[model samples]
Target: MSLSKIKAPLALAALSLVMLTGCGKSSSQTSKKQEFSWSTSAEISTIDMSKASDTVSFDQLRNTMEGLYRTGKNGKLMPGLATSSTVSKDGKTYTFTLRKSRWSDGSKVTAKDFVYSWRRTVNPKTASEYAYLFEGIKNATAITAGKKPLSSLGVKAVGDYKLVVTLDRRIPYFKSLMAFALFFPQSEKAVKKYGSKYGTASKYMLYNGPFVQKGWTGSNLSWKMVKNKYYWDKKNVKIQQIDWSVQKTPSTAYNLYQSNKLDALSLDSSQTKQLSKKAGFQLINNGGTAYLQYNLQNDENLANVNIRRAISMAIDRSGLCSTLGGNNQPAKTFTSKGVMYVGNSEYTSGIAKSSEAYNKYRKSEAKKLFEKGLAELGKSSITVSIMADDTDSGKKTVEALQSELTQTLGKIKVETTTVPFKTRMARREEGKFDIMVSTWIADFNDAISFLDLLTSNNSRNYGKWSNSEYDKLIAASKTTSSSSDRVKDLQQAEAILLKDEGITPIYYISTAYLIRPEIKNVYNDNLGGWQFKYASVK
Candidate 1:
């Protein structure tokens, strides 16, 4: 799903406001019967995998349409559309064996569907936001750049059941990538039938996964996903339906959960403080990092390394984690914990102590750096605007940062701009803010998923920060034949990024949520959020 939706890491400010506004609201169960129900603070953007970039759309895409593989419990990859696959010795080619399956529209699913979908996503005219994920595929980059035809792409259907793929390099995590939404197949006939509005309404799309969405107009705060009778493994689908409501206030959603209206609910700081001891309270370590992204292209002041470093060190991260209180931990490096590993050793654990210390809070040192930075810029004062989503936690984060900036740098002024989740991301891409809080969720299980975003050429490198040595490290990691060398290259690259303080590391997020004790079989993938395909109500 939308691994990038900020992960509900923080909750709203006024519990009283939610209680008052939601006072007379009845449980969702009062109006309709459903096996499971939940709420999201953010809204779903699109169901089309090619256009969808947020977590909500990813979640919806996983349920209504399937990829080559599916994520099972504990984030393990399981067979979905493809029953099995084989890879060449050098890892440049893959061949998948398709299982017998039918789309909701009663047409048999075929290998050609995957080829058409992939070609459509990378086609320059289509302009899918996630097409960069196909970089290693032959001609994918050229096709996206308008230099080659989509026909030149390396994927082909060897008859109706066999799908072949060729890559430019060894992709160790390709299987995991195949499980992501960007790689999901689409029906050519359906795309041609719906034209430009294929994913805007429930009726315009076809379902091949566990559920079929109904009654969604693409903007409503509520919707339903009914079990797809045509799903290949329908016999194993335990839940008949899932109901979703978009609720921004944490207390309001918690109330819905308490009344048996919802099967699960996300907790804010206040809610977690009161309920962490209760049964069925679960903490989800999503392995995502939230950080401060500098507008390297627009803000001349932000280009000064000393100014960025001063700002990075001013905040009290340990105290911040204590106040926020949902198993949150200060980020010591760019790549989060439990994400990258070789055997039992974590990548960050290898960071030199001096390099790792840059992430800690040091008020006095920051004050000194700020004075020196002011001298270097020859400016008496500066104002910075911090942009983030319009959620309870975002408000709190801004307040904390503003407070810290004032305490550490008396000459600087701090301002905050908040908006809806989708709008925040859009503004970020347009480079409209001085500084913005951005979250990176793992696209696959590899460390490179987090490392590749800032490599100068990537469109997602909104900050416009560049370092040749760091780029070389990443490039070497990708092309080299040695596993040990790749890991070492990544280790060196992270150290370099941290030393430069390219982005200020805040903390790694853990989703603190409440679930009904009787609910069973719900699964969380490598990215945060649940997959309800196997969920059931006791």
Candidate 2:
């Protein structure tokens, strides 16, 4: 299952204040006209991807909104709405020439459109959960904190087709960041006209990418993305429309796929074996890590390190993975393998030393840790609340963990809480629960995206886990020039984090989608989950 489906409620709730916001099925009434239609397990919680904090809706919106740049099949960056760009000698400034583009409404897309959108997102009043994505952008942090005015933000529109951006430092993966939904340009007219209703549904906003949304009820179970006539690359863009519906049941999605009513669907653990033999069944590796996060700030027993370590040791990741599904490997690091690169070098390949002492898999060792923790805290029992979305895998994992904890950790009571994707996200931000199941998808191909959340101030820190030394290493590595030196620094930082048991590492998630052979140029990246540009159904 996608992380967004599990954590959608809480993530959406986190953006509830400034937000204006905003799934699938198949039908076969077809002609020779090339059209691509797919179904997600759940409907998108919001359509305003720029302000979105979750990954699921962001992936869909990436198909609708063109960013400053986009990623190609090779993982290299390519121009999206920007026709060309120039970088200054200092590597701190970038100037982009925007392609002639128009909104679905026939209004010309202008430089001011980007300027207004960037300012609105970073505005302190907006309270965008994704505001931190603009860290390197000059004065963005200060402007978002209300220490400076919006005019001081590092972006400026030189003309109707020119955009100039200044950064605090040179970012290697900066273009990939621009390809994400958080950086997609928004219109000032749309925001003001809809005011609080912006991005609520298909009609709430305009599109500039290959597809424009239509026939969405905002709160309903269905929506569609029609080909955008005003898109800059309309000539090469295929797929006239994409029809989507929401089916929360894994069985239903599988049945639809089998009946040829749906072109693609995800497999549950039960369906994995049976469907692996079917034609067009292939696994798309998406470097994602799934794990349980402890709300250390709330629970007294969980606030102690030994107890947290004990819980980590008790989890049988191998068994849990078997129960969940195939095409997944147990994770030992927060940033999974193939997640980031250091000049064609795997970042953690050399530095993550394999030692049984820190491996955290022994049940006997876990019991010892739990007993020691109890003695220190003077408590006989520990009750932990495990929060998850209301889904099959969510329920299964929670049950498995509960059983493991009860059997391994003496006198432990594991309570379970299940809610919709949006509500769970709200509870996570307010620190309303104890331990929860969660995953972080990379916003950019950088280890810092994973490591920075443990910093004390990140609002995304649901666990309230903190380590000053880890923060120092992550900060230093970001500015370091030598690739080898930076990799070592990151590895050292991961060592400290794992030793501290900041979060339990489960397994890196891989995406499983069944696509028609005729579908061309559909690409996904570790940064944005997926992008639909260059895709054609023929």
Candidate 3:
């Protein structure tokens, strides 16, 4: 399975938001097209589902590996290895019928493949960043916590073609979550055969998805994906090959596009302004939220809501939007707008009113809050470190924030630290900084994908921010059968989070890309990742 499915939810969530906004970046074409080359700003992290976390690896994996279900041509959930699934009356049990399929090496894909894959991921030793996504599965939490054995994970392969999964509760987004790469089955034989070195290179992994990575060194800036003959639906896989290059510089990618060496190009803030007037210029709403997380574990002051609110209020979100480019918008809530819809209204728009003050630039109020917070802390001055990605855009963004905060908030000395994406992620996971600049693409399309991070016990809650009332509201939304009522509960949860300044919302992402007219069926998912499964180059 393409590991990028981990991040696919972020891009996939855009499908709902984009359709509502009518800002889709693609148009369809029927002409047969073939052999396309692409570029990425970041490098792949890993193909191993147990370890893959970043968007690049997820994007690569989404195409190279097959999941139980795959996002189809129209962004609809479509069956892949599973012929179909049946849901029980209560919606807590799912029985999947596996299709007759073979791995790239010709071994039949059995139900045990899924059983083994899920067990391996939730096993304490595997240390999967995505293990948290398995919370709804019965015994999944216990297995990951090392309290239960793998066999207790509540998933059973009834027979070669039948698999039954019992979840602890109803998950409205369970189907979409299953379609993600993290839920895809790994060939047990292939995994154990490669063992420690599995997923480290293209050669070590087996393929059942539409394509398989070819010539991938596991850390190369260049590689290829060729149509996998072993794919059960390979006949409909019109595009036989995809070429890839990792280019962080937009100008370099633009030059490559001009030279016909690249089929698509992503524009930077500068490029967006320069090329947006021309045809094929797309500014896609990715339904992604970028924000700042305070590491309450790093400092006592970080735990103070007053300090967080002051810092959040000092942000000039409108300025940040223009500076960041790509048609980014100042975010009004932690959850990306359009992530959920209730009665033709957006989930973000329907949230409870709070003194949380979303995106209002109030330097005086921020200064007052900072002063009050300092008094409460009984401190004269506090030094804070800002950890951010080392990408050009990331650097610029952090610098912009640092400048804004330093200029507005008194006595708050700022130290800026920049590192590669992986290193930064490690730091975030370890809770090693005072504040961190981060963006989350939806793990699955829902407000919870964003709000869930604020829960005190969530593994991804690096900040250590917690509130019981907020947790209860979110916890209730999970089991609520009424969609409208659930939305109301989620709205209150988001309001409580913002009112407490649990996180500083910055902006929602918009994917800006330059596409050649010949590239067809190119769709960007809600989470800010691209789907190239149905893409073709004429």
Task: Judging by lDDT against the true structure, name the best candidate.
Answer: 1
Candidate 1 accuracy as lDDT: 0.74
lDDT of each: 0.74, 0.69, 0.73
Write down the TM-score of every candidate: 0.93, 0.92, 0.91
Off by over 4 Å in 1: 1-3, 7-34, 342-346
What tens-digit string does per-residue lDDT give for candidate 3 at 407-482?
Answer: 9997988889877555766676777888977776665556677777678887677788889999999888887888
- Please rank every candidate by lDDT, starting with the best: 1, 3, 2
Tell me how candidate 2 scores on lDDT. Answer: 0.69
Tens digit of per-residue lDDT, candidate 2, span 37-114: 665444466776545666557655767888888755534677788888899987889998998999989999988888
lDDT of 3: 0.73
Q: What is the C-alpha lDDT profile of model 1 across 1-538, one tens digit per residue?
A: 1234342111111210001112122333534333667656666667777787666666677788888898676557888888889999988999999998989988988999899999999987887767888988988988899999999999999998899999988876789888877788899998899998899878889879999998789788778888999999999897777777767777777766677656667677777889898876887766567788899889988888878888999988877766666777888876766565522365655666767666779988888888888899999888899987766666677788999988888889999877777687678668898998776666566777777776877767779999999899988888888888788898888888888888887887666777766666776764554587887766
List pairs with backbone clashes in candidate 1.
1-55, 1-58, 1-59, 2-54, 2-55
